[model samples]
Target chain A: MADIKSPVPGTFYTQATPDAPVYKAQGDTVTVGDVIGLVEVMKTFIEIKSDMAGTFAGYAVENEAAVSAGQTLAQLDG
Target chain B: MAERSAIKRLFIANRGEIAVRIIRAAQGLGIHTIQAYSEADAEMLAVRMADEAICVGPAQAAKSYLNIEALVQAARDRDADAVHPGYGFLAENAGFVRAIEAAGMRFVGPSADTIDRMGDKVSAREAAQAAGVPVVPGSKGRIETLEMALAAADEIGYPVMIKASAGGGGKGIRVAKNADDLAQMAPQAQAEAKAAFGDGGLYLERAIQSPRHIEVQILGDGTDAVHCFERECSMQRRRQKVWEEAGAVCLDEGIRDKLCASAVALAKAANYVGAGTLEYLYDSAANEFFFIEMNTRIQVEHPVTEMITGLDLVQEMIRVSGGEKLRFTQDQIVRDGHAIEVRINAEDPILQFMPFPGQVGSMRLPEGDGIRFDHFLYEGYQIPPFYDSLLGKLVVHADTRAEAIVKLAKALDELSIDGLKTTAPLHRALAADISVLTDSFHTQWLEPWLEAGNLTATP
Candidate 1:
């Protein structure tokens, strides 16, 4: 299991928008180039993507939770 | 003049050293200090030092610092009698100032109308010209067409700077050396201006080669203004000043007098109140200085002026905002010694000055004579990845410019912030550089020196 980390400190969102479904959920398959989440800071939102293909295990941070750089976002099962 | 009211409780809408500075100033005046912070600034020094603290919004600036509604609401809820925007954020936002005033709290800066007048580069120029200040050779207003831009460029002479009337912060500016250059650069500058400022207005000014960046600090109480001399802030990168020193030693006494007078004239013309800085480009070859722009709020390097004038500017701003007259006249204001300030930012100079965010593992600050360290960082404080990377400001003073530089260098050597990459090493190099030591460099000098790896290689 490898943990995916946030690249920036901001509020993390599991979905693109509040009305949209979660980009990725537990046990869902994600691959490279997949935007699993978004981090909003300083009025800018950045997409959090997965680099390694795997089954999404679970999120370390809840939706809309504050996160810091290098903090775990989600776990990936190879 | 407005009716007078005491600032019994003051709220500072900023973070970092500036926030700390304003809080300290308010405390000195026996006014209770309230600090508004984002969630990320929970452990900040300003938060700890203020009389009261509130988290107005999340870590994102738009929801907190720059949000006029949130800031005004926080001030009102805290029962803050006044609000001091300690630079950046919404400091120069006239709309924010209006909102604060609308909430029945005095905004500790210029009036909303004054800010609106000076915020626009085009009208600011017109106001300065109306005051008989020497302005740069440029177009009267925003030039919309390439043909007009080219014609203005030719009239202003070669090597013209095409700038966005609505743009600032080192963006939407281009230097064209010839008509061909103008043709190629004007459209690009316009496009950038449109994208960045939501305004496509363009203007032309004759570019002064390797000019020194000098600025005059002025204090006003609605009708009258006085200058507190000038600061040589030519040590800049991307138009963001790093190290600043009070008194441009290169200027003769006569030139200095006129420069300062021009600043006062302009400030008075605009009916500016509180602390404002009028920036200028000093051309040594022509021995003339031309108005560049005006910063309508207390600037980041204001400590340099404070050190030299023995004037607590933040306190003055608060006093003036509360409808009090200036405590002292121009003749009574004494200029003492020399002062230098170096901004310590959490950035990796080796990595193209990228912001380095992390916990401050341990820290040791310089102490004693003529040294002032303004910051909110404590040991183990996690530097937020959001917001600006400025960690603190180190200011030092001495009887002479040479002594001030030496003192600043020694102070930098004693300063330490472990577990974070800082610009301390770069500033130390600048202090030791012969050109900087002799005060021979200009605004365009620092970038190429960094590009050459002088911070690590030569020094």
Candidate 2:
């Protein structure tokens, strides 16, 4: 198991917008370079991408949760 | 006057240095403070220092600090008797002031009507003109059509400024050099204003070329007002003040007296209460000054004034808001010496001052007599990326301007913020710049100097 950490400090959004679908779900298959979530700060958005391929275990932060740099956001289980 | 001592619990509806400043002042007044924060500010020092703290909304500024309803609700929930908007976000917001008032809690600044009157640039201009204050030479009020705008531009002469009536934070402003530029920029500026501020109201003013940016600090009790002298803050980049000094040495005593008196006049005309600032453009060559705009809250550089005057402006503001009158008269106020302030932000000057949002791995605040550092940063503290880039302020005082500059430069050299990039290097370069050392720089000088790649040192 590996912890996915956020690289920026902002509010984590599981979806692109309010009307969009969640970028990833529990037990979903993931691959390296796949975008998982977004961090919104100062009106700018940065995409959080996967670095290692694995199964999406669970999210550490809730939808629209505030996060800081290096804060764990998700878990990947092989 | 109604009793303001009734305000025992104060709600600080802001964050960062200003929030900390207000908290200390309120504490000194024997009033407890509650810090209203967004989710992003969970570890902010202000939150920890306040008597009580609560998260009002999400991380986004619009949903948190700028959200009027959320802030008011937090005040109610915290059982706060008054709310201090603390300079930004909702500081000059009329709707926020009105909402706070409607909740049966005192808003620490001026009334909503006063905010509305001074917040609208066009109306503020009219008010200044009505009060015998000399405003910039353009635009009687908001100009609706391009033809009218061009007409005003021509009358004000070329190189006019097209400004959003509701603009702040350096947004929604365009400088037009001629008729063609005016035609091209007016509508584009209008669109941006509407998009950013939700108010597209545009007005024009003759650009005061290379004017020294000076502002007078004032305190009022909704009836009487007194001036706290002036600060020379021409050292700005992209319209944001970076370095400020109290007691502009360039000003002759005669001009200083007039400028401060005029500031008091404008504040009284607006019925301004609490601490506020009236910005002006000083045309040194022309030997005249013109009113620019008034900030209806405490300023970031308030300590510079405080150091020279030996008065606690924030404390006085709270006392006045609590139904007290001005504590000191004009005669009692005196500029004892020179003071300088430099703002350190989490930005890289080489990358056009790009915001470097991250955790502050470590920091060393310089300490000495006549030196003050106002910041919320702590070792291992997450410098949140969601808010303004300002990380801290370094203020120093001395018996003379020369000594003050030397002390400021030395302090900057000692100050360090590890992990994240800082504008400290830029400030270090400024401290070395001959123009800054000589106190001869103008408002438009810093950007070009920065573009010349002078900020090379990293501290």
Which model scores highest in DockQ?
A: 2
Candidate 1 regions exceeding 4 Å error are A1-3, A7-65, A72-78, B1-5, B140-158, B161-204
List, residue by residue over B151-182, the lDDT tens digit for candidate 2: 99988877898999888655667789899999
DockQ of each: 0.31, 0.43
lDDT by residue (A1-78, candidate 1, tens digit) is 988898767678899988999988889999898999988743357788899999999889998888888899999999
* Top candidate when judged by TM-score against the true structure: 1
Least well predicted 10-residue stretch by lDDT in candidate 2 chain B:
B450-459
Question: What C-alpha lDDT, on a 0 to 100 scale, does residue B84 get in candidate 1?
Answer: 91
Cα displacement (Å) at residue B233, model 2: 1.3
What tens digits encode model 1's per-residue C-alpha lDDT throughout B249-362?
989999999999999999888877899999999999889899989999999998889898998888888888888888888897778999999999988787677667778988
